[model samples]
Target: MNLVIVGLGAIGGSFAMRLMKQGYDRIVGVDIDEETLQLALDKGYIHEGTTSPEHVIAEADIVLLTLYPGQIASFIDENKDHFKQGAVITDVTGVKTSLIRDVERLLPDHVDFIFAHPMRGSEKKGIAGAEESKFKEANALITPVSSNKEENIKKVEQLYKDAGFKTITRVMPEQHDEQIAYVSQLMHALSVSVVNSTQASPDTLLFAGNSFKELTRIADINEELWAELFSMNKDALLDSITCFEEQLDVFKNALVNTNEEELKDFLKKARLQRKKWY
Candidate 1:
């Protein structure tokens, strides 16, 4: 199948490489950056590369949108007419509610847009940072609206399976947003706060342990991309933050009151819950 990957950044580029390794050649890449497109070609992640969506979108059997939420909607709105009839379009966008609503409304009837988010990534950006191993044994969430065709949804599920994801889950768009707000967005927010809480000296960082480094790894984020994600899912993210703050308050009170039992209970509960997660 001919595939078109929009936005040749880390996620997109990694998808391209994995798909190529699976013997699905004829992959084309689209990006605003000419340098990135050339790099994708040089790395053999794509057989063809173009700076304009209109140039290669029509020929794609599957169009994988790996751009930010806002950019994905805009690209679909502007180039929906060029999409091949019966072509399946999927995305790697983090947030989905507003994006799905907008793109589905503007999408032509001949083409289908099935929203999917691969639950894997690094704290790095661009094609240079793309790694095929990121998708190995990772979970993927496929969010399909009521209007989505059943066949198209299955095709998207298979797409992720072929890309090396270990698990593929199906969820409604709003439910996906709510869950991701807690599991994904909240962690990024916490990481940013932890990194910014103090202006640590280089020597201080040198003395840090694995826990500190792991917790703050995502703090080195892409501001422009994450800003869009945080804003688009503001309500859910804020709710997660409020819930987190309430839990933190309990710990604060326990420490302030010198309640050893309460502190132990909190730590014990956390360890038990985390055990269930693993």
Candidate 2:
């Protein structure tokens, strides 16, 4: 199979490495940065690397787009004609509603574009940080539009499974966005807010614990990429924040009233709810 991975950043490079390890040859890496392409090539994550997709896209059987959501539409708009006939295109984008709708509308009928989100990543960025282990035991969400062919959707699902994902499930784009708003985006916002709430000092490090370090780990983030993601899913994220604020207010009121019963009940319920995940 001839596979092309666009962007060649952390997630993209990791995907190339895992797929290559699974015995799929002809893996190609594409990126705007020549240095990133060179790093991917040198690391042996891909068999070939290029700074231009136009030259190699015609022969690609599958293309994994790891670009930011905004860039995906523009890239597809410009290179739709270059895609090989019957190629299956997938993505690792975080938020999906607008991107999936726009790409579905613009793509040629000859090819299939199945939207997917591999629910795994690291705090690090770039090809140098790529690791195949990121996908182990992670859930991959396949969000397919009505226009997608069932066979093509299955192919995309199998692709992730072959890359060592533990589970694959399907969801509509709207639900995917809503769930991600709470689970992913809201957590990032909370992490950033927590980290920024206090000025850093030697005293701060001296007093830090595992909870503090774990909570703020994601706060050391790629600002530009996260800003784009937060903006693209603004409405859903705002709804999530409002929900969180309501719960926080309840806790604040309980503390102000010194209601031990309310506080205990809240903590107990939270503990019980969290236990369900295990």
lDDT values, one for every candidate: 0.90, 0.90
lDDT of 1 at 45: 88
Worst 10 residues of 2 by lDDT: 196-205
User: Model 1: per-residue lDDT, tens digit, 178-252?
Assistant: 999999999999999888776766686888999998998899999999999999999999999999999999999
lDDT of 2 by residue, 47-161 (tens): 9998889978899988999998889999999999899889999999989998887787789998999999999976788887788776888899998888888999998988899
Clashes of each: 0, 0
Q: CA RMSD for every model?
A: 1.3, 1.2
lDDT for position 257 in model 1 = 100
